[model samples]
Target: MPLYKEIILKDNAKLYLWKITEDIEYLKHAVKLNTNSQNRVDSMKSESHQKGFLAARMLLQHIGYTDFDLYYDTFGKPHLTDGKHISISHSHTFSAIAISNQSIGLDIEQVKEKILKIASRFMDVSHLENLSETEKRIKATVIWGIKESIFKIKNIEGISFRNHIFEEDFSLEDKKATATLKYENKEENFDILFDSAEDYIFVCAFEKQ
Candidate 1:
């Protein structure tokens, strides 16, 4: 059980992260999945993806829930049968989920130079200035993670990371920030919490109440 980190947020909401160190075979046999999930996993084309999917089920079991308790709506957003809001994300070697009493979103991203290549695609480049190359990449990855979390919360079509979401100015030391989602003639705010582990950044977004 590589349950890497468990965070207890406000209002009984919780965040769970799993470091995927096991083989696909180990994860496949460790958790029970419904027919839909089984078929879904069987259809995965990549070993990395298959491992991430299985690791998610293991995370569910870590928190005493199973695949039977989870389902997706027509919009493709996952929901827990017990009515808890859930958002999930998987990076190269890490998977994360956030369960909350209110709308929530989570994302894990590997910090690498590739994000810097497309920084302007989803974030403001000025935000990267005055920082070392490594910090720039890490910060850019955090911004991408921020936007992804917000997108998971909204789940609305046509919300472009560049055109719709805006993350407030914050230094790395802050460890927290705020963002706004402007879409469909509506504007909503979200609170963001982020951290780095093993070169990966994990972020969680909670809709402003």
Candidate 2:
């Protein structure tokens, strides 16, 4: 229930993951939130969402930072007071945050069959071929995470997952891949690293230098 995992990425980015097993009350008591975060959590209609938000703060504290040191820009992208890049994501019962000296993005998604049903909308369907139903579900979820992570890094408007983001062909065994964001007449490359935690898939994206 504490920090579930810590990953030191190849790019030197540090990622922290937390499994949300604590009740909302316990999480509320564990971390101090700024007034804005408190109001944001109070406005959440779902207890699960609130727990996820708190779990993220719990991770911040685990790494020697607190809510007061974190803030969101006009686009809602999170940044640290010390100028480190930060990205936060929570899904189902998992919460995760990634920190890097360079720009970065992080996303986590629960593996579900539903992702396969809509895979074509955001990814190249051909990449889904030659895989079992279960693999398809996991791969689709990863691709979705890929696009979501990249979008977080760019934090720009008018980017479409189905149109601007693209993932190259990759097999599950690879455990990593690459993607490109072609938006506004410019193409940016990103290095992607992904893995499964419990039933969730988490992806991290770092812009290529």
Candidate 3:
């Protein structure tokens, strides 16, 4: 699959998704990676991980950028050389990236029943009340992505999903929500956008200005 979807969340922010249908060999030859990225891919033990890594770069090329224009900071957050904010995520068969003029975070996760088992560990389980088993799983997955995306935006140390990140109550049909981060005596808010693709949930977070 080429580009699974392209979403213009805002005038300055966009999201790109790639469904990983091609083999590693096809992805390897589809995009040219820098030496560092090539070495990183070579060091990956899981073919799924390698394909996800490569698919991300493939998306960059589809958007007129490449691996060479991307770099990471000491905290392992990705940034573009041209000063655009970038976040990357991959789960199972899907890879995605969000680029924006403002700080942003992106995350994709496969919906699974296991999330319900540990939902209390990272989110407010009360939010799960009155839902069918399937809805609970999807909502839990989205809340998890909400916290993950916010963490990516902050990239700070000692932020616990259970304690520090909080998602406001929202229904599945809303497809968007807000979250708060209370860590180290600092309180910050973020705008959240999320949707499902197949069995996967992808979320985007933007630091509220």
Top model by lDDT, which number? 3
TM-score per model over all chains:
0.97, 0.98, 0.98
RMSD per candidate (Å) reads: 1.0, 0.8, 0.7
Error of 2 at 177 (Å): 0.8
Evaluated at residue 151, the lDDT of candidate 2 is 96
List candidate 1 segments past 4 Å from native: none
Q: Candidate 1 residues 1-209, lDDT tens each?
A: 57999888666688889999998889988989999999999999999999888898899999999999999999999999999999989988898888998999999999988899999999989999899999998899999999999998888888999999999988998889999998888899999999888899988888898
Clashes of each: 0, 0, 0
List the candidate numbers ranked by TM-score, top first: 3, 2, 1
lDDT of 3 at 164: 98
lDDT score at residue 143, model 2, on the 0-100 scale: 96
Tell me how candidate 1 scores on lDDT. Answer: 0.91
What's model 2's overall lDDT?
Answer: 0.94
Error of 3 at 21 (Å): 0.9
